[model samples]
Target: MKAILIEKPGDESCMKLGETAPPALTPGSVRIRNVACGVNRADLLQRQGFYPPPAGASPILGLECAGRIAEAAADVTSFRAGERVIALLPGGGYAEESVVDAGSVLRLPDALDFETGAGAIETLLTVFLNVFQLGGLPSGGTVLVHGGGSGIGTTTIDLVKRAGGRVVATVGSDEKARRCRELGADAVANYRSEDWVEVAKQATGGRGVDVVLDSIGGSYLDGNLRALAEDGRLVLIGLMGGAKAELPLGALLSRRLSVIGSTLRTRSPSAKAAIVTAFQARFGADFAAGRIRPVIHRVFPLAEAPEAHRMLKASTHFGKVVLRVRDDER
Candidate 1:
């Protein structure tokens, strides 16, 4: 089977396509003929040797994939061979084939194509867990998303609207702000311009937002706390800007606010399974009914993964960038 191997990673140039032995089937796992794989910032980080796959995980970079089941382990009962599915992986999605835990495998809705499915799992699950599960976005409440044009950002916008919540988002450019609005964000602000915290306040009529999803961790942390409403929750999902930051403990004590941080890839298998189960039961019908949709920004052939990495690093694309292993699959 063909796979993207990071041979002692230094850059995207370190990622090479080469033939390797197909992954052998294991109990409680299923082999997928990967039709498409989603590229993530973590993948880029892994390529540069900043992140490594967890224990017992494939050394490859991808975190999620969509495809048909080639084989199912003996314990797998709910899913079968030849079934079309998409799955969350701890690692090892950037390949022609992959073996995923049956518990993490989900049957894609009939209405969704493989390309969209490839793009769906990581961002949607990440946003859902942090924004709604942890941040507690109640119906009719206001939520603010930083990096509004990012994969997680755009997905959070849709999820917030679907849950009957309002969204205020910060993007780097006017074009991205427009994209956020198109995804049903109630208000958009340019983070590169004036203070987005002030803009968010005005958007919410000075009430501030109930929840905030922030990936920029350095200078934005204090500002994110400032932008939160009384008793609001702030969920930090990434440290894209930088890790070190001076936080205002007084603000949290005075406003009674909470700040939480999470990453999906580093989670335990049971925890991931639980998250997937919750999402499945909550949104399965909506997905099948064609209400919630995956937002795909672009699709590149599997061999051009380095270009995809470059594009992700450029931070210009909105939504997810997928690598199509089989064009006909979608």
Candidate 2:
């Protein structure tokens, strides 16, 4: 099999298509002839030696993929050979093939293409688990989501709107603001030129948002805390800004706020499987029903994985940047 390998751990140039042995299907798992793979910021970080794959995970860099099952374990009754599926991986998504626990695989919707399908499951799972289940954003509640034009951001906004929740998003520019609004954000704060705390408060009628989904930590910590309504939930998923931060503990206690930090990649397989099952049971039908759609901005060929990394790092894309492992994966 062919997979992406890193010759060095610093730049996109370190990535290359390399040959490797095929993965064997483990009990309760299935082997996929990968058709497409989703490029994530983590992949770039992995190549730079910042984010290593979890123990016993594939060394190749990729987190999510859509493909057809080529082999299945006898215990895996939900999926079988030749079935179309999408699965999240601890690593090794950028490859010609992948082997994943069957419980973690999603039956691909008939309406979705592999490229976009390859892109959305990870983002969807992250948003669903964090925003709805963890953050407890009510159906009619208001939310403040940072990086509104990002893949995770777009997925978060679309799902919130479809679920009847109001959303306020923060963006880097006017164009990003316009794009976020077009994607169902009720309001957008141009963070580059405006105060997000004020924007969030005003959008939610001066009380503040019921929940805040933030990727930028430290530098934006104060604003995120201030933007939340009383007893609000703040789900911190990334630390793009910095790690250490000084917080107003008095304000947090006074407001009865909850701060939760989370990440998907480092979880146990059983934990990930539980999330996959929960997501399917709760929202699988919506995806098949066309209530939610995968937003794909660009697709690069399998050999161009490095370029895909470059594209994701540029942050110029509004949605997912996927790799086309095979033209006919759909």
Candidate 3:
């Protein structure tokens, strides 16, 4: 199988398309003839050697793909060969084929093409797990989302609106702020030019937000806290800003705030299975009916993964940049 091979960690030049042995099937997992792969920041981290695959998982970089079942174990009763599916993989999605746990695969919406299917699964699951499940954002509640023009940010805005909640988002530019508002954010703040903490506070009529979905940790920690409503939960999903931060213990205790952090990659299969089940049960119908849809920024062929990484690192694209492994599959 051909994949995005890294010859040197931390160098974009190291990312080249090369052939490697296809992954062998796990006991309970099924094989997917991968059609498209979703590009994520984590893939960049893995390429740079900052992040490694979980124990016993494939060393390949991709975390998700959209494809058809090429092989299935006899024990896999719910899915079978030729089934159209979206796979949430531990790794190995940047290839022609991948092995994924049967429980981790979801039925791809009938009308959704593989590129959109590839873009949809991971971002949907990530936002659903962090903002709604962990952060406890209620219907009609107000939420603050950082990196509002990002793939996760745009997905969060749409999900929040559908759940009867309002969103206040922070972006890097006035133009991106407008884009976020057009995507259903009740308010948008330009963090590059203003104090986002104060912006978030004023946006909610001084009450602050009920929940915060933040990927920018480190220095933004204090500002995130300041933007939170009393008893609000801040779910930290990434440390894009840096890992270290000064703690505001007094403010945390006085305001009864909760700080929670999570990453989907290292979690056990069973744990991810639970998250997947919850998501499918809750949103599967909407997906099938196209009530919720994917937001794709661009599509690149699988061999041009290096260019995709460069695009993402430069922060020039909004929503997800996808890799079409097989043009005919979609």
Number of residue pairs clashing in candidate 1, backbone atoms closer than 3 angstroms, sequence gap of 3 or more or interchain: 0
Superposition TM-score, candidate 3 onto the true structure:
0.97
Overall lDDT per candidate, in order of appearance = 0.87, 0.88, 0.88
lDDT of 3 by residue, 139-186 (tens): 799889988888899999988898889998988888888888888999
TM for every model, in the order presented, reads: 0.97, 0.97, 0.97
**What is the Cα root-mean-square deviation between model 1 and the actual structure?**
1.2
Residue pairs with clashing backbones, model 2: none
Give candidate 3 regions above 4 Å deviation.
none
Candidate 2 lands at a TM-score of: 0.97
Model 3 steric clash total: 0
What is candidate 1's TM-score against the reference? 0.97
Error of model 2, residue 144, in angstroms: 1.1
